[model samples]
Target: MFKNNNTCLAVFTGIIGVVFFSAKAVMVKLAYQYDVSPVNLLMFRMLFALPFYIVILFITRKKSEEHGLGVKDFIWLLFFGFIGYYLASYFDFLGLQYIKASIERVILFIYPTIVVILSAVFLKRKVGPVQILAIAITYVGVLVAFWDEFRIEGSEFLTGAGLIFLSALTYASYLTGSDFLIPKFGVLRFTSYAMIIACISVVTHCSLSEEASLSGYHANVYWLGLAMAFLSTVIPSFMVSYSIKEIGASNFSVLGSLGPVSTIILASIFLDEKFTILQMGGTIIVIFGVVVISLQKRRKHT
Candidate 1:
């Protein structure tokens, strides 16, 4: 019963996170007005987020069992952190520089499908036939949603698409890697370590790239940076790991599809980006796919 409660809570958090993270493209735009490089931008964002997530873990330490993270755990932790948070966010921000937030979000939404495929291939999990069809439907939706720019066109568009694809792959790998530790370390403990490690990795990357230095940015940009860190990075990171722990990856991915939809809605509001007919149709198809995925899981459990 307690587990079930956590599951519900985690899912709710993930949903809220979906909404929170959708503003990232906008945040990146606001930050760019200060002439900040993507790397420097990410450095400030992650650096600020580090303390916030750390404080939360410190306050709730009692809920988790502290374990010795020896060489093996740290090795895995560092790898996952690098790939999951550091690489994913870095590429995402860089990609956003060349693409509209609305387009970037729709592209990033492909990660859910990637997660499903990776789980089936690497985890050797059995997905129902209906689930397969649902995924196909979702893919169709994704293509339809992006038909405007998926064409063979400008190098900038191609680059944005490539970088976003990398973000999705790394993010998918991060999801898979988390599953490796959650069973042994418990969700919260593993999460606490993973985040701290990723923060370190980002710092290291910044130092090596000479992006560690902060300068030439106005005071106004700091607030936007904080909002990005807190809203997009820290909160969503915690919620995603928590949701993965509670509901399992597939269901989490089920909820994850809402991200692009949420991003679109947020774009509509803050970006004044109007929705196209194809995007609306794509959103409907994606939702239908998620429904099919969930129903398939229920059917299997029964």
Candidate 2:
């Protein structure tokens, strides 16, 4: 009974996390209304998000020490932080400039399939027929939705889609590469460390880039940045981490299928982005493919 109760709680937590995470793009879209550059906006997010991660890191210091981390590991953490959070997030923010929030969410959701491909390439994981078929299904769905967006949004859609795809690719690389690091440092500690690295990276980049000034934004832009930082980044980060700890990563990942669906709804309600039949079909197909991969992972673990 207790186990079942914990699972139920984890499910609730995971769902909320997914919703808040999905809300990020909407918040970004809203912020863009003020003509803020992606780097400038992202700088605000990482800045607001920085303190919470610092607290987490301090709290987890003892646990982090238990793992005998070295200079080599820190270097890798820097790399992971740069590629995973910094680059991926910057690309995602830039992509949002040109694409609808709904389309960006769907494209980002394809990270699981990218993870499978990355694993097969780098980890020498065997790709069974089931995995291949799922990959095919996933990309076909992406293409269908992407083609529809292209028809309407024209040439700029390709640029946005390409940027979002790169965001997914880099994030997938992080997940694939960080498999060992998570176990060693623990999820929260490792995440905080990586996030700190990413925050520093963003700040430094902003300082160097003349176009990425942090001044002269409307108050709403700052408010939305705070919303993205807390609602989307810090709070959900901890919630999703707890959910994963309780219910396991595979289960947590399966629950992530709700992310794009929630994003679609949120985009429509908040951003006035239209919800079309093709988009719905594509989302369903993509979720189906991701579910297949997640289920396969569960089976392998069990």
Please tell me which predicted candidate would have the highest TM-score against the true structure: 1
lDDT accuracy of residue 210 in candidate 2: 87
Q: Write the per-residue lDDT of candidate 1 for residues 1-302, one digit (tens) a residue.
A: 56445555766776676667777778887788788888888888888888876887787688765466568876887788788888898889889888877778767877766777777788876665665676677777777776764654566887888898899789888887786577766766677677777788878888899555677788867888888888887777777777787656656666666667777777777777677788888889878876676555444445
> lDDT by residue for model 2 over 39-93, one digit each (tens)?
9999999999999999989987886674577888878888988998899999999
Residue pairs clashing, model 1: none
Q: Compute each candidate's TM-score over C-alphas.
A: 0.87, 0.83
Candidate 2 segments whose C-alpha is farther than 4 A from its true place: 1-16, 126-147, 239-257, 281-302
Candidate 1 residue-wise lDDT at 201: 82
Runs with alpha carbons beyond 4 Å of true place in candidate 1: 1-10, 60-62, 66-70, 295-302
RMSD list, candidates in order: 2.7, 3.5
Give lDDT per model, in order: 0.75, 0.79
